[model samples]
Target: MAQSMSSPPPALAARGSQGIILKETSGSRLESTISGSECRVMEFSSDGCQLAWCDGKSVTVMDVPSGAVKYTISKPKTRCIQFSPLGSYLALWEPYAVTKDVPAGTPNLHVYNSSGELVTEYIQKKQQGWCPQWTEDEQVCARNVTNEVHCFSGGAPGLTCDNKLQIAGLTTYALSRGKLPYKIVVYVPGSKGAPCFVRMFAYPNLNASAIMASRSFYKSDTVSFSWNKKGSAVLVTTTTEVDKTGASYYGEQGLHYVSARGESNMVQLSKKGPIYDVDWNPNSEEFCVVYGFMPAKATIFNCKCDPVYDFGTGHRNMAKYNPHGNILCLAGFGNLRGNIDLWDRESLKPIKKLEASDSTQFEWCPDGVHFVTATTAPRLRVGNGYKVWHFCGTLVQCEDTPPKQELWEVKWRPFPAGTFPTPSTSSTAPPTTIEQPVQQEKKAAYRPPALRGKPYTYKLHEEEPPQRVGAAEEKEKDKLSKSAQKNKKKRESKLKSKEQEQVVITRGSKRGAEKDDALALAAQILRGNKDKVVDPVGSGKSDSEKKLKNLRKKLTQIEQLKQQQAEGKQLETNQIEKIKTEQSILEEIEKLTLS
Candidate 1:
């Protein structure tokens, strides 16, 4: 309705039924609270703590961190209160009933500096709209009417209204961080007069809008939409109704889709009856959904609809992934037989399942190394005021405590670096020698598998190690070589000795033949049976005894020569095979290695 020039932000002042109200500081249980209702919403200002709040008919500012009043501005009944992007001024809105048939507009937005003075009343031109919400990042704020929606930027002049575009029943809009072309998906109606329209806006600040897709329903036929992890896709919930009776016919469905892929590809998710609420894993890629209603679980799923955990039925009251996306925590919903499971992404195995029975909200320490959840509710504190409980049996909470007036939306606040699940100390490298064939099987077969010929290969011939030689060792080796040479020579000599032994035997046998011939002569000379050489033993010595003794002596001579030759031969055949092997190996080395 009006516009004013810029001025310095006013010092917050406490007033009647109003007090310093500091909100949005995150924690399980808020460490801060409003000094009283009529003070300014409590904030840490450059000078001191400033608080501000609405008195239904006006807005007041105060410094409750110190007892000082800053300013006050009278306005139409205000519903919600917020500071500017730079926290320069105050903007107040007229309250709306969520179910009220009319939309949210003409809701005077007054920007006031620290002096309780009005700077502007930029009344949005669109008529009949629902929830009007600002992006948490302050980049955009959206307003929706029956089938029309418009989003505006503070930098743009005048109240820009867009009516050509459509959303279903204006269930509301979703805001997120990072770059955009924000997927400002709005729920508008389809051809059948039901609210199932989800449109993605290009510049959230303009009337230039394009229809992304529309969901269909006949009666009570509006749908609500939520963003997926990356804001690239949205999950739209719709109800189909009977045209004749104005009664909802078909049940509810949650269709998931990505804008890049187009909504036609939206996969139909299992209906958890009619979902009252649904939230996806913030780390997006790691998929998990939290739905309202008991016995309904935080079902983990891959991008495909297949569920990850076969332990299918467990409700994660609320869950979050550690910044690194390694560990995940599911809390709050479990029966008598369930565990609070912690998983390692590498192993995909539950490292720990705390049997923490009492379900309360939890927050990660700035370092993702430690996360805290409430097992049992706190008794000494305002048990009703907060849903905080002791962590893993310890009473310690966290660093940033919440303010009582603020509905605490606690995140680990991702320090971005340390807030991920701590990786265990580890190292991975191919070993020095992967000799274990079994292990080789498990490793990814690299470099195209070995030509599978035989289960056992001809033992891969490897080169032998070099022979070591120091002076003393070389001398010993030389001595050994000489000994081997000598033994070989002895073998040759022994071969000659064998020949000589045979000759001796041959000569001895010839002598026997001669003696037999001589015996025949003597027998003939004596003209009777007689011994050879009978005349030589003229005394009492018998010719037969003499012949026997001579025979023994000749046999002994031959026996002694044979024994010597056998012993000599044993010395010569000294492990000839071992020596031959060494020689062959050396020859091969000379051929291959030297060349």
Candidate 2:
């Protein structure tokens, strides 16, 4: 259900080095604040009803609506927490530790109900891939075990392990979101010259015979999967450790598509480079990929793997579709200068350009009209803060970490689907009482004292500025049919060629127009064949030589076209017309040779 009057307003939570703050997103009003200990991590329940966080001592779950503490579980050393889809249970992961008393490391992964009672526990050693995967309905949960996946059916308390997917050398698995009959995809890396493979299996029947779709690839050392919102299909991105072709240093990557109905195929990327990011549209029928080298390209593809629209090329490494799938945020962060471009999905036109240099994370608010970009600790240890901006590129709120303190994380509280309606887009930013920060003017690059006065060229590697391709050219692009567009291009090319020829004709000591006239006259005389050649007394020898040279060049081009035609080469309309003029050109050349 959408947000009711009694429901909590959408909130923004930030965890700094020493404290955590939860504030209402609408007015930036502080709702809750917990301090005095290092805030480790924070998570909102899948339904956004409860907010949970760990502070090195205990895991606290807060009822978001009432701003009251719901549960305070005494699970110290917790590194991560995740709430199941329906928010009925929360899973926590603590680093595994070996002690003299319990050397095997008592279950570090624990699941607890809303009442703070431990429901289940498992021994998950490594922090990576340690979280228990849950289906959207929360009726099933699974986790990776030694070379296999153990799945449990029913709710948290007294959950029964009724299914186990035993794949030799299983590395990882992903559970799809949404209604019943959920699908799961598992990956197993290649070994001994064997190809790596992924297999999709529906819930309840994960056996080999129950596999619905499968894909195998050779160049992958590891792979990641992106399932559309509907969970009917998935995009698999495979990566290799090294590029054997030596074309790139970042390694080779490939994208493949697999659906729930036994459809599997490789997604052919047009450019050659690492696949930076792939995101499926909320509609689940289309997806976008940002890929290729240096000036990477972003393109939207339909479910059939056909390119729907190209966002041209820019310095982008990430593509994010808002919850409504109407706006897409393309950004380049880490190594590249942080530049964000927002595009309208319908018109395929850019709507805004934003920059948050040094940002390490970006996410859209469930409302879809607001977004948050943050620069936290460890990634850069500097510029640790978060900025909330209206999707129109207005900086609505900017909070920087205090000196000596660092921001650990920032997240918008999640809400159920349709809880926040999509706001109509407007170029004008809504008025906010919070004062926006004044962006600092860019400083000039430093030059050496010795070369200060010397004329040296310095080039700054800057991201390509946004160019409004659709808006500027959409009229001509949409008004013309495909063939009309092609003919238009041809006409433009011919006009350009004519202008270039005119430039050459007007250049040099001899006027090219006169030579053209001589050629025309020679062709006319050749057509008559009996017309006597009139070499005027003052007819410049240079002019005749230039005309003869032009006629001979035309004859040579015609001969080449005729030879190509004889060789069974298909000639264009203009090429065939040029071939028809071969005899006339030969007659003209004969007249010039005889003269």
Candidate 3:
């Protein structure tokens, strides 16, 4: 029932009609038992330090570790007891007989501090199925009855019923958690064929005038709502019938996004039919919805209700978002092999799928990296326990509930803060220095020539003489000639052996002696050795040489044409000069004759 991070094993306080027993889970042993009147209900505080129990007429608060009674209060008829989330106060409900002396509207619930001091009492008409609810921070307590919601706040004198809000048709409610300002979401059914409304009320003072109702949707009888992690927005899933059938009918469902300030937006989640569920991401940036009927599909959506991603999950039964992380776990009953898929919000994809057959419950550890999944099992069977798992689906531990005990609930304790070592802050003290061992530089090992990355250079063992350039060329030519002769002899021998030898057509032997010879002759020609053109048999003259000869002839022709053009230009210049002189002389004669 309750576990503490400070302790090695979890402490579970089990209560039955006989007595109350506090058992340690690490070892199958009872630590302590408070045996008296039949205990009706027992609950451990959020901090796991205190345990409270109520029998029909009296309430007892006991220290969990020492089994010591801390406080006890007795009433005429106590119905139930609930400890505040912060362990500061306890709320006990008692039903008083509605007689003539007692008015019709009688305050039956009482609030008391840890020291058993009476805090407050309210005149709420006790309902058959109504129970008091508290905000996550324990700053406000709310009691819902019919269409009215009563809220109380802790004050100087006692718990005061500060605000009471009345909606037309109240169905369900959810309280915001975390650091955001506390808000209460209440669902009000539509009146006279109108749409249902989701309303938000500020905590401590939920006045009727301050009700902020969200945009309404078509007539939906079943509505489920969940608050985002930071309480900035609330996600509402509504199922509305499409056809007016008396007995059985199909319906449509939609997911509505409403901000803390009552602004609303919605998207049709299932065109096929009503959506099964919707869960919000821990960061309040996105949420996921399970839609479709058979072979249901799961879709993740942003705050705007826009679809981010979707996957097919066969008949999804439940989907939950981790409170401390962005991982979403979806489980369905249709799959016998794989039933759970862990989706990562950052990646927008599933990171793991687990094959947990018939898993009905999932609880994430406070660390967020690990979770626990449990499956229902038949009595006296072995499959009833839970398995601790990392987010990757690896099993960390498996635990079985005590046989025949019928596990009511199992939860991982919230890890305590300040458990990690704090940094040292003694600045006045001398700083301690640790001397590290001096490491000697290691020389690299020698690598063989074959293993070295660079080409290995070897010293010549002996030197004969300084070679001339032509001498090296001559040696290469001699080697080529000898290799050619050897190839020719082999070809002749093959021909002689074969009586009728086919015409041998070779594209230069593999040794490539002909190619070497052509290269050598070209080298000589480029060096202006006109007499050394050694053309190999069966090969024509080198094309390179022919191209060189044609280039030279064209060059000569170009020079000759340039000389002829220059001579022609000189002749033309002389003729033009003579003509100009004659024209001037004729003009001088004409002028003299005219004068």
Taken over the whole model, the C-alpha lDDT of each candidate is 0.44, 0.81, 0.61
Per-candidate clashes come to 39, 0, 3
Ranking by TM-score: 2, 3, 1
| Candidate 3 per-residue lDDT over residues 440-559, each given as its tens digit | 455865778777897546532222221221445567667777778688789998878673433233333524656656654554454354664544443444665445434433434444
Across 313-379, the per-residue lDDT of candidate 2 in tens digits comes to 7888999999989999999988887899988887777788888889998988887778899998788
Which tens-of-lDDT digit does each residue in 242-293 have in candidate 1? 3343322445445454352444344433434334334455566436555434
Which has the greatest lDDT? 2
Q: Estimate each model's TM-score.
A: 0.46, 0.73, 0.56
Residue pairs clashing, model 3 = 107-122, 107-123, 296-315
Q: What clash pairs does model 2 have?
A: none
In model 3, where do residues sit more than 4 Å from their true spots? 1-42, 53-60, 65-67, 72-81, 93-108, 121-137, 145-147, 155-160, 166-175, 178-181, 201-213, 239-254, 333-338, 375-383, 401-405, 415-595
Better of 1 and 2 by TM-score: 2
Candidate 2 structure lDDT? 0.81
- The reply for model 2, stretches above 4 Å from the true place, is 1-9, 26-28, 157-160, 433-595
